[model samples]
Target: MKTKKFQGIVQVQYEQARQSIQTGDLLFCSGTYLISELIKKASNSFMSHVAFLFEWNGRVLVFESVESAGVRIIPLSHYVTNYNNTGRKYKGALYLARHETLIDSSFDRTLLQNMIGKAIGSLNRNYDQTELIRILTRISLGVGRHKENEAYICSEFVDQCFRQIGIRFPRTEAGFVYPEHIAADPHVYPMFEIVP
Candidate 1:
């Protein structure tokens, strides 16, 4: 399948691109927070976080697992326009992308629905802080391996959701995944870099 290279992807303001956002679209962020920096460094990736987009009842929602909230859904508007109600947008560069297979005609819509249901079922799951630390430590020390736990980190959660629909990002030897892994998946293609 033809794909747009990340470096050549167009940048669109959220206000202008929001209406065209679709369910299953991926949202990537390179956040400016301390944890974001740490995650980026540990993952050796430009993106620190990834989330799924769903349009529910006329509102666009972002489904993400976060350190503070675990697996939760929030308005995309709130995330981009008033994150935490601070009257400021999220501190990061945001990009929008899609998994092409999810849009293919032969791909089962029922399977897509089931995958979304599975992700929604994961709501309220705790963020795997322990796994995050372990991944960081292993990456830093160049030792050890990752083991799955009950909690979910942002990329791992998104990766799991995609896996449910038969799209698996390549896993690392450490058995861990990160935002860059998801972004680099062969089935996913860059669409836009969301701008303020």
Candidate 2:
């Protein structure tokens, strides 16, 4: 249970037992502003259509709009287009905008904790423990990397393969640092962090 501190505000450290976290455990983390940059980057593409789709039981689900600004998920149908392209030009095309329900600090930590709890709870029913942990890790690392100050946000989409199966969440010192810790600086904005 050794914990590491970051940004003088938030600190999260995983247990050594978690090092071997199987492909069935769930990892949950959250942040803000990263999703906006993703949309901005996607808009630059010449003929790319990005949409977020939640898949369950072989069916595809697309998000209409993200609660927060600048985050979107690309539809799977877009991948069917130009199937002959082998370079995976469509890879990493979709994005998830960070969603923040709070505008100010009026809500207590319980509210924030509950938000995360609900997300995890929802995920648990849909996926196995390992898959749950992998997705959470993917998002945590994705958000951790883009923490900065310019008000610009970026979206980091976890691959569908990784989403369905289980992947390891990196257990590095840098991986544990929260986005808000680094985002405190005004000059260091619009970046991405990958854990693992």
Candidate 3:
């Protein structure tokens, strides 16, 4: 019952958040897990996770890589409906942004879906622990690169999609590209900021 009520209270906020996102837009989140704290420390940014939104047959889905699930596509409802890991719902803290330079027309729908398909297909793969550590280390010293691995970290997965069209993210040589880095670009416009 407690979980049900908690879900009810946050459901409205989730809906509001969903409305703010559009197809081809990017979403950044401030998570409550302990690792989130470390990610914030490593990246020196508020956001710990990022995902892109996709509208399919009237349902909004978010594609992201998570430590628990690696690279996967989830419905927007599943992404935001539940209370955060800390069991608290904060308002206006999470945000979604779109790159001003990212025009939807530049992408071929079939090719993009194929890319997403590749991610969906890679579900059997695991999250890249080595890459995660490399990201943290590189973020601190601003040097070194993660060796190629089959696993997926959130930022690397998202960045790969954008890289498909020849868009260089973060405009940096940093070893690990971060979610905050993507959302920080002047070209990325904030779509919604809800204060609950």
Candidate 4:
């Protein structure tokens, strides 16, 4: 039997995909920072971080939790162009992905609103640095992890949002989830790499 195949990464400029980018689209980052390298090594994947997108007042915004800045939303253009407001671009590649099932189907509006509400409610909460370390340690030890319920890392935050909509990503044997896990999910497909 022939197996279903997913699309390979397509390179596209931000302006090209900007209009079509929707509320639930994903942004995956392959950062070039020290912490990014550490995460890459620990997770055994190239992608070090992940975030989701949403539109507000006709502007697309990225919603994510980072070690430096907790949960927050920033204009997608600002995020890719003047990252951290440093007048320099992000130090890595950013790719756009979509959950096929979610994007293809006509999902409930109320569910989406609830999901966005949950994410907004988490704004300014501290990034779960402890959870990140605990997850990495658990992976290293080949053991399961205990839920740290307080704050969130990028993928976990995104996972929680999807959970609000009744969609769950696959987890590791240790019951941990990472950007790589979300990237490799069968239902999610790479659309394009957003370029400068």
Candidate 5:
């Protein structure tokens, strides 16, 4: 049952992302999981996941809350680009976003990195199962939410990083902020496609 169409597809590579990304950048990821499909269907947006970047010891990494692994850190290269399934890695279609205002200031770099470090240390925490249900509910009812804590969702985790620095978004509700809103935020602009 082999098909010529299936063989025509090309795999992705790390260098192809074309990012001149700084130490700290926010990445909005379009996922391929079954849950991602549900999220995309609900939000009517290509993005389903959100992650933030951190540079440590000259290597860049991304930190986020994922449904399966909870809060974790992976090499930035792995975040945006494809990883051969034969190897040990997590891969997805990653789109990037950054707040130029913060990037331009060039102040508080150490403090920001320190805060992200603390959040990273909180890894292996639980992903918000309630939030997932809330997202599903919003899809059906067009309005739904549950209190957020103990477990963190992707957008919540990204928001918390800013909250720690006393930078709160205007509509700062964890359950209400979806990936689409994050991607559409005025400060966040599309960087480039990862070529998946």
Candidate 6:
């Protein structure tokens, strides 16, 4: 892996992942911190910063920004390969499980709406709800109809994230249902309408 500079950001560029130090760059760093004091300070402050966990040179690195608008880029190869290349085996499993356990054809709009609400509520405790929703919405839109398993995996991962943050999520229903009215009633449940 080579550490390169992109637009004045210190970046570690690898075949699978890339890192950069730039303004507005959020890094979801994983692993133990060497300087606990600095980590504490950064964690307490930098609320507007974007950070995420990424691997570099086969090791995980904490990519942080000293300024705003800086982004640390990590190619998906660092985490997992493209689902298309794997014949969607992993994706299929995720979808079947979600469809069987979390969502099914018999589910009403209210249940789906409730699931979304619970998902959002769980995320709100740790990150900004608006931002999380934006991210999730983008992901959902990109998923389309063909990637059912991918969507299911994403939903399940989100639920797990909520749990990790000590947020309790409502039990999601099985199967998909329509009659959008259930989502329209604000008093009934919070709905995250996916826009096409």
**Which candidate wins on lDDT?**
1
Tens digit per residue, CA lDDT, model 1, 1-196: 1222565578888888887788889998888999999888878888889999988898888999999989999998876779878999889888888899966879776776866897889999999989888888888897767777667999889888888888888778878888888888887888888877
Q: Quantify how close model 5 is to the true structure by its C-alpha RMSD in Å.
A: 7.0
What value does the lDDT take at residue 178 in candidate 5?
A: 70
lDDT of each: 0.84, 0.26, 0.65, 0.83, 0.66, 0.26
| Candidate 1: count of backbone clashes, pairs at least 3 residues apart or interchain | 0
**What would the per-residue lDDT of candidate 3 be over residues 7-43, giving only the tens digit for each residue?**
1122235566666566667867777678887887777
Query: Which candidate order results from sorting by lDDT in descending order?
Result: 1, 4, 5, 3, 2, 6
User: What C-alpha lDDT does candidate 4 achieve relative to the native structure?
Assistant: 0.83
What are the per-residue Cα lDDT tens digits for candidate 6 across 26-85? 222221333222322432311112122333465543222221212223333332334225
Q: TM-score-based ranking, best first?
A: 1, 4, 5, 3, 2, 6
Tell me the lDDT of model 1 at 28.
87
Model 2 lDDT tens row, 121-168: 333122122322333455545432222221211111222212222222
User: After TM-score superposition, what is the CA distance of residue 90 in candidate 1 from its true location, in Å?
Assistant: 0.8
Poorest lDDT segment (10 consecutive residues) of candidate 5: 1-10
Name model 5 segments beyond 4 Å from true: 1-13, 16-19, 80-92, 170-175
Task: Between candidates 5 and 6, name the one with more favorable lDDT.
Answer: 5
lDDT of 3 at 9: 24
- What's the residue-level lDDT of 145 in candidate 6? 23
What does candidate 6 score in Cα RMSD to the true structure? 20.3
In model 4, what are the clashing residue pairs, if there are any?
none
By the TM-score metric, which is better: model 1 or model 3? Answer: 1
**What CA root-mean-square deviation does each model show from the true structure?**
2.5, 17.3, 7.4, 3.0, 7.0, 20.3
Instruction: Give the per-residue lDDT of model 5 (tens digit) for 86-111.
Output: 35334446665566656667667666
